[model samples]
Target: MPVNDTFGDVRITTHRDNDDLLSAGLGLRGLAGTATRFVQPASPTPEELRRRAIQSSWKGIADLGPRGGFGSVYGSIPHVPGREFTSFAYLPGARASHRVLLQVPDEFDHERRCLVVTASSGSRGIYGSIAVAGGWGLPRGCAVAYTDKAGGAGYFDPADRTGVQLDGTRVRAGSAPLEFEPQGLAADAGIAVKHAHSGDNPEADWGRHVLQAARFGLAMLDRAFPHEAPFTAQNTTIIATGLSNGGGAVLRAAGDDKDGMLAAVVAMEPNIHVRGGRSFYDYATEAALWLPAALSARQFDDVPFARVGAASPPAWMLRGAALRAHGRLTSLMPGAQAEEALAMLRAGGWTDEVLATAASSTSLDLWRAVAVAYASAYLKRDAAHMPGGFSYRLQHAAGVAGPIDAIVRAAWWADGSGVPPGTGISLDGGTDLSLDPTLPGVLTLRDLQTGHGADADQLRAAVDATAAELPREGLPILIVHGAQDGLIPVAFSSQPYVKWLRDAGRTPVFWKVPYAQHFDAFLAFADFGDRHAPLLPFGYAALDRAWAHVAQGRALPEDAAVRETRPRGAGPLTAATLSLPPN
Candidate 1:
């Protein structure tokens, strides 16, 4: 058997005029429009699912609004007719399967063969990094490969025993190889997510998954054009790129590439941890415990989604007071309690900019969702039986349990975010066993973090496996990050990682963009767009510089610098808005 035989049941689909690889045929115009809709919400065709998935994934990762400069200055709707090959790659004897997709555009330059491999940014679907990697690779006639890193919108409903297949269709759990199936789900359990319930600690193997995707991409290229015979890393140029978790994945791949499989790497806003850096689960759980209360601080009153005119979220203030009453926070005075909570976070390594951007995440209630899911993964517990009564259930509306929504079930592979509180699945914090309505569940996670028992030991071990190390010596590397990113602050991630690299005698290009934050999708909000610049354009510019240095031996900027960015205030974006640094 061939080495790439691990990529099983390869299914190839050719896309052309009506449905090209880049935009799923939506074109630049359709991509800029509202959300893509299915004719039959309950039973969308495979093609419909692909198109919708592309559009949603693109919009989720890139800023495509009128003033974001997606199609105008930097991006396009190129007709890169190509064949897409999909398959499942797995570890030895592991039941969980990671989705690997390879797209070979018809314009691929065989003589100067190039390939770009990426992992999904978050728990999003396989197309999560399409806007980041695909936007740059396809136009340059490079074959692009993507992997979900075993964390995607693959939802398995224990109630119905159904899950999504590789073809973006539903199938009974046993009918085929679903992406994930909880080992021991209860009879009354609702939905089992792949990333949280797989019991695989998928993040531990993200680097391996990216490497596997690269091998699979090269193997598929060999099959796509047999006349070219063999395609190996030695004969081709392979560049790894991704943002957020995907960025972390590519960095891990570069570190683990002892076989010379990768030539260069560019990671944007990566969620990485070094020896002294903070872990994502640690900060995410901490935020879940205190960010709600921190939002009540008077300083954040003007932040987007933090308050409406003179009124802040009363519930948030209540939660903050509850923390003080529980002795988790200081200051008995209600007005001073919130400010104290903010101080506590700052002492724990949280930056001021991160706290400001967190208001939007708090408004969305994303911290709790992340806390519950990560707790389940780190504790190696089943999501159906999470501690402190945390579980996911199908909800028709807030506080109303119901059967799975037909449309949500049908669109799981495309629209789902691989976490609850999305795609119709809502997180239940176990009836709030305390006076604080929301304190008990989060406190349980905080306790697990502070505990020294086997539970904490296991959690620490799992997180340790996700730590990033210096890449193989002399690999061209570039990192671009938004200074205002709250989710993965540069102080704790890129800053320390870059420092570690330099200490180890490696020079990596690092660009910190001012007035830019994570979640380009949030730019749809006028207030957010007005105050912050999008990171995608800077990401593209970094890719251009990295590619030139990697392929043409161009010298990259040796010193790290903070980029000058001007926020578009109630007006259209212009080149001056980005202030992209010269290469």
Candidate 2:
């Protein structure tokens, strides 16, 4: 049976990992797989270098934060009117010392309304973002608060890579795990506790992570502000919103809000509802997903897919040079398939000369996309700061992702297992019957490597158990997706959830943004792509409607068309301009 437990009286402590960094590396999140099975971590980044240089403190302030999340959130809350940023320590899970970095809006009335506990881009950006870009909904009667969720903060844009020197070569920016001692920062920030435990960068377990996040929200409400019923969303009463992983989390919270703590969720471009296919899946989503992996794999010294003929290729086969990237991508498939893809591109006027230059080739871009996609799906998706061993995180994900991928390939791959695994409820005694509402039809990260099938029925049960399903009652959902989303297919990510809502007899407000990709790239480009951008105004607009109903029972805009235009003459593209045709 799954562990069914609860926190007695949550104890807040300085956020710490279960093991020290050096130990963690030798432990679970440590050096992974055999020499034969390839997966590796990276050398520290420029930020990490700066952190090491800082060592201890600057005037007793923790020197570690300056390069990343520091200064503004610590000390006294900034005296900005209609806005304040602060950090708090809380126990989300029992004894789990975590920090919730927050930015409270100016319109916040601690005594009456509740601030929508949201997320900041990367570690914490939304709290300090430009509103036209969809953050800190100022002058809109909207109040906000956010947390880092983990990893100190997520990757800083362009696939979370920052260019760095490695072996005298300029490696593209990618996920670089670093450990920072927080003694000075914690004390200076006034969040230090007597029994300070330590935690480091760790792998992700959505089940545990979401539970802690949900708990964090309630704790933030009770401990950080005056205990009110919390700001509402009309019918559901309490509302939660976030982007990307944060978006997926609020939905998880709603499903697990057994005490009726939440009423609705506004999840933008969530990762759920993605299907099993890898090769023959969403072209756009896959391309964007893999780009980072191609770059990150270099840090691991991965054999390029161009050389797949050498050793049958490792699981994460991605080696991309800016020059030969297109040819490398086509070689992933055997024989005729590669020919087919190449012919398609050739027919479209993609000559060799065109393919050689990175900017000119659609094929090269696709190569970069799949590279990052594989890296993310396999090694880097839930990379965050947590209380566990690095080895455990890696193995946990691998055990789950590897086997799960196998099951997926078997059932969905055309050249896979003849017997297919159908959707929803599975017959043949293959699904885990224990649907524990909070994490229904889900497989905890630990469960990933726990069991695999020698039997067909067993594998089916394993596959069925991995999905995330929760209740829809009381929670009116407003799913806003971009029609042109390249990170997640609007069809795969949102349409299925719509089906679930309908099946439950609930009418969720599903709105699609025209010409919008996974994010507001136009706005992001204007900011020089500093952070992981939010979905276009559609999500925020939906939230406004939801809040209106909650605040004064106003009606939300009934199905509507939301525009997300990039300005003319936009090159790389920005939300300010209309998106241009493919080059």
Candidate 3:
């Protein structure tokens, strides 16, 4: 059994015994069990969908009552009306609700008759916002909705006690009701939807979310716009799309809601599900992570729960973020805390060197190497063996504490494989550990497991429940993972999902980009620089293909698998190279 048959990091031989090791090693910082509230979708009748949708409306958005309680984040921005809607998500807790900072494109076409829903991979960086504002889905001249993941949404207040809600509504003990605001898309002549909370699905809250959002959004398109397509799950096709987590979620949503609503699903650099046979690793594979403090703070809203913006500490936030991450890179080292040392650097205005490397360096090692060289540039002598006096202290203090965050975390959790799926520690969650402007350390595994009041039981539940949903038969889909994806090992979904779907007699297209990482890049780029542009066309292509198939029943090429490669030098994407089964 190859390693890819199992979880990317989990060794087939060791996974059964190392569940805790696996979780802790990945820097999950929470003791999450598999989630509950699982939905094993059989075809839901329109009446069932309608009745449930109606009930959801009454219990969901109706509680908020129109868009009255919601406030606009973008003040006086023409063409793009950026608004935030506070609603409930599916999670297990007193405060299981979430919200979306939506964009209603000025050019939204009611006549185009499509609602493009985007999932924010892990809810970090420009996760869902770009997809909505001007990225993939939004550019299609359709309405766009974006939100943070459950982990992203639930990071504040570190204690197990639920954090404060954005709208300040009293959350009851049981699962908090989902917040749905289809009418909020009123500006776009389309619809809006706030599904279950954005965290790992602890209670398996996803069952109702994707469906409800689709049904309600479509119903609104019909009832309000009238001229727009009147799409019931049966009548019209809906496209489900997302990247990483969102990518995985959309595919799961389409699988679970098979033969309904979803005309197709477009998952970009998604962590897909392949069948885990007798082992976690079907083959040897590597994983990657995107750390914080990289390029423009990844766009968080000004809300209290947000990591940046008005609520966080002013002087030390980003610096603190980098500092906090030092140990994960160095990993349980004897001494020389990067967090403390970084503080010293920040106080002296020395953070720019390492940060500049972080922004440009494609790999974490380059980031670490650059930082070490810059820190030691002032050394009196050239490289030599044991230098006792001042040199020993200086090198031990700073040079040795190089980046091991991604490495240590991946190794610890992945059965010593050294590459893990997804980021175990939360980028935003790092803020919870400290506020020291200079040092304010990132959240370490110890901090995640013990420091914060994370509920072990709840964490366990969310972890298990959030596991990728297996692809079942029934939906015509196209799953694309960037061959260049350094994060969330591609084998996670590509191999296993293909195995599962094939076993189930389902045939969805799977495409891998030769030079894309999470998102594909143009010529010559394996995966960095001018990042967003390379992926835009791929995203649009996936959706366009899915829409054509789901809505029009058009047949796609029989090429089961293909790798998209670009020219050696900078240029546009070259045609894909298809893989045919051996004769």
Candidate 4:
């Protein structure tokens, strides 16, 4: 009888002695048995072996039967002697639950191992798969039995030792509740207390809830891959990254564990600090004084005296001032020089009809007056108890105002130049202040300014800290900045961060998309112009290359292209403008 080699390299030669054949069969069966022991075993048949071989690409089994019918017959047999199987389990904890599973291969190699886990599951039925391929080919007697703990959900302090579960396949334990309190001026001025959700307490304790959820997820991972444990080295590297609120949390986690736990981090648009103090007040004061004068000057033809003694500025004027202070007023002010500002505005489509409405002198004057009003309201509601009745006062006293002002002024100048153009008033369409109409009308400009400042600071700190830990030689860091971002000026945030990283011997790439605002840039990959079109894809491609370098443990290219060669999208002002100068 002809013998065949079916299960990989395992050679099966027909033997004359029945005892020898039985012993060989027993040895193969033992190997399969060891692999399936981790999970509930499913009785295997000849048909199953054929299916397993096809799935795993084990050539040894293919030699046993006919082409198409081989798998059917192989799957029908009760025992395959040398095959593998897998299964999983879900365990619940005091605060959360977890899912654990087993992964086995036909032949066990010391270096090759398997751990099955649920990657994704939803309304669809459950499915199981291995995290890593190949079974650790261990010599028959040297294999160690997998052990771990199971689940339960509750606040288990890392320091406390209660309600802990440990088993051969999984482990579970509780952790301390997460702590969250408002930071910056919001916390310092005691506003958080007055605004507290309910009861006598002014602050909400939602951190505990979030912590419980995260811990539960961790527990699930623990149960699924019981063989793996949290990295224990004192100097082992830990990297954390996230977007928006999650980004802020990741940065906080890294900072909190800075000493030894977290080694690196990547947080995008984190919200860490609050904007409070004299700087804010100063901007309000400037807006109040400057806006009226600016608006009066803009109405050289109509509404000449509108800014002289207006009862109340128009809503559009207030929006304009707020936008200007936030480094988003490029549309209102244009031209290379102040002399050309009016002409540039007119050329961009600001008509006399638009000016004749005179709801509040000129848009500039209206903006200033509105700024003052909003500031006054904010002082009353959120900063009444502060030293100067405003957080901006302290900031001015501390000498930080100069630097901050310089940054804002530079951004404003850029906005006017059409360099980083912003959306502005038009001949036909009214101003489109990107505020949601459903929100309370009582929301003052001061609140918007304060929130925007706080969020910007947080993002800056997070990015800076994260960049500090990254290896100078790794992948290139791509920075995307919206030219017309009102909440966070691209020049102040992304530009400065990139400069700092490069100065520190790191490869940093930057792309400034025109006309694109903060939220819009994230929503789509746009082409600005022929010269700057591929900007978005360039960033993504660079990121991919960086990841490739990371996998190879090599540094990213320093001289790689950092600027785009095609137009990506319209700049902020470009999008707002109806007419364009001929090339």
TM-score of each: 0.96, 0.47, 0.47, 0.32
lDDT of 3: 0.34
lDDT by residue for model 4 (408-433), tens: 22121111111011112111111234
Residues 22-67 of candidate 1: C-alpha lDDT, one tens digit per residue: 9988887788777788898888898999998999899888878887
Candidate 2 residues lying further than 4 Å off, grouped into runs, are: 1-98, 105-107, 110-112, 120-134, 137-143, 153-237, 274-339, 342-466, 521-534, 561-583
Instruction: List residue ranges in candidate 1 displaced over 4 A.
Output: 1-5, 308-314, 397-404, 433-435, 560-562
Alpha-carbon runs more than 4 Å astray in model 3: 1-95, 100-112, 125-129, 132-134, 145-208, 219-231, 273-462, 468-472, 519-533, 560-564, 567-583
Q: Considering summed lDDT, which 10 consecutive residues are worst modelled in model 3?
A: 279-288
State, as a TM-score between 0 and 1, how close model 4 is to the true structure: 0.32
Kindly give the number of clashing pairs for every candidate. 0, 50, 53, 77
lDDT of 3 by residue, 1-583 (tens): 1121111110011111222111211111111111111132222222222222112211211111111111121111112322222233333342234433333343556554566655445433212324322344444555544434332322211111122233322122133432321111112121111112121231143333444445444544454346655556554445667766566667667656643566667776665443332111111000001223322232212211223232333232344244445533332321233344333424422233223322222222222221111112112111121011111111112335344432222111111110111223211111234443212221222132223343323332333444455444566667766554444445445656766777778787776554444422112223232232234345556666666665567766443333333422232222232122111
- Model 2: per-residue Cα lDDT over 1-583, one tens digit each: 1234332333222211331111111221121211111121123332232222112111111111121112222111122233223333333342222334333343445444544554322222212112211142433333444443332311111221321121111133333211112221311121111111123211122324344444444444445444454323322134567654456545555555555555456777654532242111223322322222232322213311222322211112222221124342444333333344345434533332222221111222333222222222222222221111111011113344344422221111111011111211011111132221111111222122233433223323333333445654756677776564544555556667667667778676776655454434223232212222234344656776667666666654555444443222223323344321111
> Which candidate's TM-score is highest?
1
